[model samples]
Every structure is written in C-alpha cells, then in structure tokens.
Target: MRPTRSVDYRTLAHLRLPPAVSDFIDGGSGDEITLHENTAALRRLRLRPNVLSGTGVPDTSTTVLGTPLATPIAVAPVAYHTLAHPDGETATVRAAGDAGALTVISTFSGQSMEEAARAATGPLWFQLYRFRDRDVTRTLVRRARRAGYAALVLTVDTPVLGRRHRDLRNSFALPPDVRPGNFDADHHTGLRHASPGHSAIARHTTEALEPALGWADVAWLRRITDLPIVLKGVLAPADARRAASEGIDAVIVSNHGGRQLDTTAATIDLLPDVAEAAGGHCEVLFDGGVRDGTDALKALALGARAVMIGRPALWALAAGGGEAVHHLLTLLTEELSDAMALCGRPTLADLDATLLAPATPVCRHTTTARREAP
Candidate 1:
C-alpha cells in the first residue's frame, strides 16, 4: 500500500480508520447523551472578542501541574495506541514534545512508561488507573516517577466500564497481537477475561472506585508519590472543593470524553463552576470534545488552565503515522494563536468570562418586532 500524505486531523477523521474502529472510538453508549453534550455545550458559549485591546503577540505559554508548557494543551490518555499506529506512544510523545506540549501517557499504552519517557523532549505525565491491588497502583506510580514523568494523573471517572455500544456491537478487542508493554500478563490477569467492549483491566484492577474514593484515598495516593497528583473527571462543584481541600495539585475537568457517563453536564459547561469551587486552590485543566483551537480557546476563556485533546491525536496517527500527528498538532497550535490575535487577547491571563456570550439574539422576538414597526 502507498503511504498516505498528511492531511488535517480534524478534517481527515474519515481517513483515519475503518468504519468499525472509528465508530467504536467516536460513538458513545445508549443515546450517547454525554457524547453529544460535550460538543453541543461549546456552541452554547459565544466568544465576545475585544477590538481595542492591543493583543500584539499573545502568549500561550503557561504552567500546568507546576511544569512549564509552551501552550496550555496536553494529549489526554487513550487506550491501545498501537491500534492507530505501529510506533504507538513513542510517536505520540515525540509529536507532543516537539510542539512543546505535554503528553499524558495512558495506563494502557502500547509502549511502557519508560519507553515513552525516553522518546519525550517535553514534559510528561503518567495517567494512572488504579487496579484492584494497592501494590499494583504503587508499582505503576513508582515506575512513572522513575521514568521521569513529571506528575501522576489519576483518572477518576471510570469505575465501571461505560457502555460503548459500537464496540459492543463490533465485539471490539485488540487483536491478540497488540498489547500494553508496561503490564505483565500475570499482573493483568483479572483484566484478561473482560469481554470485548468492556475493559476488565479497568474494572478488575481497581476495587476502590466507589464513592469511598474520597479525601482519604487522595491523601493515601499522595503518600506514595511525591509527583503532583491531578484528579481527572470532576464536574461537581462540591467535589472540586473537596479536591482543593485535600491539597491535590490540579484537577482535570473532564467527563472521560463522554465515555463513562451518559447524561452529565459537558466538561466545558462545568469548568467555571469547578474553577470557582477550586478558588484558585488548585489548577484546573480540561478535556472532552476539544476538536480544534476554538474549542481550546473556549475552555481557556472559561478558566481552564490547560486543555487536553483525546481522540484527535489517535485519528491523526492512524491517518498518516508520525508526520501526520506532527501536522495535526501544528495545525491546532497555529489555530489557537490565530484565534487569540483576532480576539485581541494578548495572553491566556487576558481571557475571561466576558469573552464568551450567547450567540442567540439578546432580545425577545416580540421586542424586536415591536421596535421594527413604524
């Protein structure tokens, strides 16, 4: 087969995968209520650009989890990257690193944490999905820290596997050939029996996924790793407050890319509440439905310290391998810069809630008609 030239990742979703795989990745379960909501919520927010403010050269530079980043964006964790490209996490790290963006390596990555770390030039964070055994979680955390990961992102949204109907209908399973090099077969024994569409590893590995995973667990996890711990998948203001009170480093306001929950508020819609709840006690990051730079800007304007993109990176990698991924990141970063200039916002700090307004007409229809009459 001839090699495909790099195309726009956002525009080239069609070229990325077979129909079955794409559906599994893109489609959510039941009515896909949350899946659609994540994107739909963005439409509800309108950008009210400032014209007179001299944007000059906008500064995208920011620090997330206390680490410097060229842009306030990171790659969210996804499973089985080898399914997208042979290079897997290695290629992902390089692309993200080259762009001076952070890469959050998934717990189920095709490459080991150490392998991905070696390929990175920019900062890296290890995405941790706690398994059944405390030792296992500790082992992974220790490994990530040893491998030079700057922080630990504890994925809190997935307790039980979300119903991904497409994957279920397709009986989606990683072909026997693809595996996460980081885990030994014995270490992941319980996960082996999980049926297609269900992640036994995710399910069997962590028994502490209940509501009991409160301040104590957060404190316990902190005891094990000096690396900053970021709690992912928080939408509730109360929970955000709890996270801040617990002395965690950051919170990733996400909904698991709309995979786990079915009817929750969109991550972006909930961002301001969470940020307010945080009260500047901790940094707030965002993920879910971030397809382009406008989406990134929307989250930033709403008070997200940084934003992460999930499926887009996989689609780009699958579409044309490493170079394609490079192009995809470049496109997004450039788009963000363009957006900032047009809005007359010179830096992320200049972004505020006023930059967002409802796109709908301000006055009622009756009011408009009354004004028009002679």
Candidate 2:
C-alpha cells in the first residue's frame, strides 16, 4: 500500500528492513540522547503565524550554492542505499531529480559515484570522508569532478566512527549481495568482517579513515578539484566563521544526524549561531531532525539556505524504492508550502526570525504558602 505521509514510510521501512540494517539506519551513538533531542528541539519551536498578510501561493523554489531547487530541501548522503533497495544511490538520485531537489552522494555509497551522477537530472553534490590514503581521496575527488557533481561536501566531524550500541549489538555488516561500489577489490577486502557484537563498518572506518584530518586538507581538496567546496558537520559558530574566512562555498550545520555525538546540541538549535557567524559570507545549509516541512521552515527562519533529509529518504527508499522517495519529497515540499502560506511567507525571502516564537519550558519548582502549619 502507498504511504500517505513521510513518517508512514519510516514505519514501512522498519517492517521491510532486516533488524541489523534497520538499527544501523535508526540508532544513534551512546544513549541516543542527541538523536531524540534533534526532533524534540524542532518540535519545541513555535511558529508565529500572520493571518491577514495577504499573500498568494507561496513560492517554495530556492537555490543553494547557486544550484536551483524546487524546494529548500535536499537528500542527504546516507551510505549503503543498496541495503534499502537494489538500485541504491541511482534510484535516490532519480527520485531527487524528479522532485526537483539536490542529492548528496556519500563517499561510501553502494553505487559508484559515476552511476549516481548519470542518474541525476538535477544538481548533485559528492559528500567526502578523508581516507587514510590521500591518493585514494584524490581519486574520488577527481572522479566527482569528472562526473560533473556541483560541489564537494567535506564531512569534518567524523574522525572515527561513533559507538553506536545498536550496531554493535546487531553486529552490522553489508549483506553478501551488497558492496561498496566505489572501493576497488583491494580496498573492499578490509571492509569485510564477521566479528560478533561489533560493527564491521566501524572497523573498516577505523582502518581506512584519516583520524588526523584537519583544515589543511580542505586546502588540499580545493587545489585538487574545481568543484565548489562545502563543509558539512559544522556545529560551532567559530567553525562557521572560519569556513567563511577560508572562502568555503557553504557550511552545513549538522551533527551527523545525531549519529556521532550523543548529547550534542540539535542542528536547528545550532543553526542560528552558525548562520550569524557566517554572516552571509557563505551559504548555510542544515540537516538533522528534519522530519517535516515545518521543521524545514523553522531551519530556514533561523537562517539556512536549505535543509537535507537523511533517514526519511532512507525510509522512503526501503518502503518502495524511487517512487516512495519521490513521494516523501513531495510531501515535504507540499507541507512546507502550506506552512509558508499560513505563516504569511509568500516566498523564501519572507521567512525570517520574526516568524518564530520562543517555546515555553516546563518549570519544575512550585511556590507554596507555609502559613497553614502555624
């Protein structure tokens, strides 16, 4: 049956995916505090609606890093799409293009970057992780550039894989039929493992990823690729400022979907600071806990050029491959349009901080009179 809502796909995915694969996609690091907090934080924000602002149908179209989008939403780079469906990243790209959104292909994608690019009709960006081999990293960057990807999204926060308890408990591994298409035979060998109570991907990451990666590598990447560079996983205002100073094309205010740091501030909570620090020097994109259009609207109001949907895309893919993914994007776009119309925002430009109202927190302390005892 076709799912009517974006979250309905999540339910369908949970039923379709194997336990380990589902856990890998759903679980977060440590106690999963930040994972839940991400959405909770977004829900806590109140939208201040303007009733009489006479506005027609709202225009949802916008651009990020100069790439036009039908809506201010993009599909985030989530590895191993083959785990969700056989077509993998190719299907994802197609769906994103059909929905008039961008797709950021992951470095650990199950489909080759070239294939993903070929499938994409709209803008595409390649998300990068610094590998231990600089030569291999260079090869990937060159491949992305040759494939005509619009930008290189450098994920900076993952020095090492986070301790996801669910993955560990499930002993997560790519099913035999699925493999990382980008890795050559020699590189792929290290990614295979059969250790119980451990994540094979985590072990692969530890051995293959560069833990000592720094800003200098960003310079190295710029010299190697002509494509625009975007720094993802930036949660700090200072880092956003530095990215602007460094002339980076954009910065994604993300916390790896709360998959890395367990108790870190929600991406939306950090968006304002990062946006303020960037100060229009570079574009600010956001990801993490964007489950609906209102959440995307809130992120934009706080100051984000666009937002990315991660798990929801995966859920949609698992539910019914490309078609479901397109449905999910459409739902988000429609919801955002509704939110904009109701908020009196005729266009993306009209969405501002003024549309937001501070959420009231629950107070724990209570006052009582002591005179009754006397």
Best by lDDT: 2
Question: Global lDDT of each model?
Answer: 0.77, 0.87
Q: What is the lDDT of residue 282 in candidate 1?
A: 91
Which segments of candidate 2 are over 4 A away from where they belong? Answer: 359-374
- How accurate locally is residue 232 in candidate 2, as Cα lDDT from 0 to 100? 93
Per-candidate RMSD, Å: 6.4, 6.1
Cα TM-score of candidate 2: 0.95
lDDT of 1: 0.77
Candidate 1 residues lying further than 4 Å off, grouped into runs, are 1-16, 186-212, 358-374
Please give, for residues 243-318, the per-residue lDDT of candidate 2 as tens digits.
8988899999999987897899888888999999999999999998888889899999999989999999999999
Error of 1 at 292 (Å): 1.4
